[model samples]
Target: MSKLSISQAAKLKGVSTQTLRRWEAEGKLIPERTAGGHRRYDLAQLMGTKSELSFTVGYARVSSHDQKEDLLRQVEVIELFCASNGWQVEIIQDIGSGLNYSKKGLKRLINLITDHRVERLVLTHKDRLLRFGSELIFSLCEIFGTEVVIINRTEDSFFEEDLAEDVLEIITVFSARLYGSRSHKNKQLLQELKNVARQL
Candidate 1:
């Protein structure tokens, strides 16, 4: 087997040198060390492998357009994290209620996962992906051999407030459908319920 230097190995793998280093550190790939203390990768192992390569992506979401700044901050953090790890990351952003899974960005993410193109997913927080049923997505990732990386565990109090609003919105929609939106009595009831929801 021929030996390849770090740069050559990185080029062959189509990843950055830092990524190669990280892989080594994570024991995913360990190179032979020279007497001069330089790392050398086996070219055959790096290039002749039959395993498929998958892509990495970062995802960010906000429950409303008012939280656009927060979403941008999440994107910045994800970009910085991927850059530090020397990963070329694709970022997906969504502006919608977490309770609603029909968002365009969320659908795109699911399609990518279904296509087996995603090797890894990075999220700022678990709730950033979904207000609920996040574990379901995690299970799908596991089935697809995709790794999930959550950068922060810190809870945002405002997220709970947003979730309450989402629940209220869902309730309002259903109630309107059941009671008839054109009814003045139903509209008054919805206004009263919304006021109560805001207080919660």
Candidate 2:
């Protein structure tokens, strides 16, 4: 009846440390407290057939670096949501275009899903996960036995604004690449043209 620390227990159970913590919060596996109030799991608990606990992960993202405040808000909301549910949550975040799948945080989340380490995934919005192909990820989660939770299901004015901004960013990139760099005078002329188009 050897007692193992959280890390050791997680290793024995083939799960992440976060998963073990979540299980503890969910009352799936109760660990004994050391004199110092540290958690110590009994090895037998890790090998128990009755414990079915898994980790819950929260993901947040903003499409632009300038939206740092929005990113923080998303994280705060996720933390509050998880806390309210009495869930121990691991939060993953990204500061990149939703169309970019190479973001480190996004990649890590996907890897966790693929490894079946995630029992549940919470996102502030579907677009926060990806601008497109989000259904593919959802399908993968289904196959991996991970549940998806979106904090916001209805589209809002903010979503429309973000979509328009993304469209403008794409247009700017293609416009620059196709027309090459413009002289200051030409740039001013283009701005004036944009203003005229807006007025129309």
Candidate 3:
């Protein structure tokens, strides 16, 4: 029932308005035309392309300090998957912690969903998009009929941090609370964890 203008649809699909217009002319991405000769796209149709539908939409996010510094690489991975399936992606970038909800980047992403511009959101990892409880985000996405996909769930042993990653992260947090320097507690936490291991 919801409709998006050609421009809006173009952005959601990661294409130009002219491309959409051209596609409409060539029957590539024909949206329902209004009486005024304007092209309007249906979000539902765009999401389900198998049954003669339109391009599906995808969302991606990452923090600033992540080792995967290049968000484009992440976007390309997502975009390639979507593109192969004739889907579109509206990528958003932000520089902050995943646990922080007041992220400007995430706010814009939520706004896009509110405007019915997103269908399925894709994240490389749950921690990339979220850290703690993300029930509110999931609930809003559900309410807006948007789905989420975590591309990678299994932990990567490649990271030198290994299983102690989360534990180290916790130590960092606690250290930050106790003292301004987080790295200061890393040595202590490592020693303590090693000591505890020896006792056990």
Best by TM-score: 1
Q: Which of 2 and 3 is ahead in TM-score?
A: 2
Q: Which ten residues in a row have the lowest lDDT in candidate 1?
A: 47-56
The lDDT, on a scale of 0 to 1, for candidate 2 is: 0.75
**Local accuracy of candidate 1 as per-residue lDDT tens digits, 95-189:** 88889888999899888877767767999898877888899889888776567888887886568677766878687668858576588887777
Residue 144 alpha-carbon offset, candidate 2, angstroms? 0.6
Badly placed stretches (over 4 Å) of model 2 are 1-54, 181-200
With candidate 3 superimposed using the best TM-score fit, by how many Å does residue 5's alpha carbon deviate from the native? 25
Report the number of the highest-lDDT candidate. Answer: 1
Candidate 1 structure lDDT: 0.79
- Please state every model's RMSD to the true fold in angstroms: 6.6, 10.0, 10.3
Q: Rank the candidate models, highest TM-score first.
A: 1, 2, 3
Q: Between which residue pairs do clashes occur in model 2?
A: none
Query: lDDT tens string, model 3, 1-200?
Result: 47998777765665445546645665656698899988789988765533122224444544445534455666777777767646556567665555567788788778876764555677655555555656777777677656666666785322233223434444556555555455666667666875553343
The clash count for each model shown is: 0, 0, 0
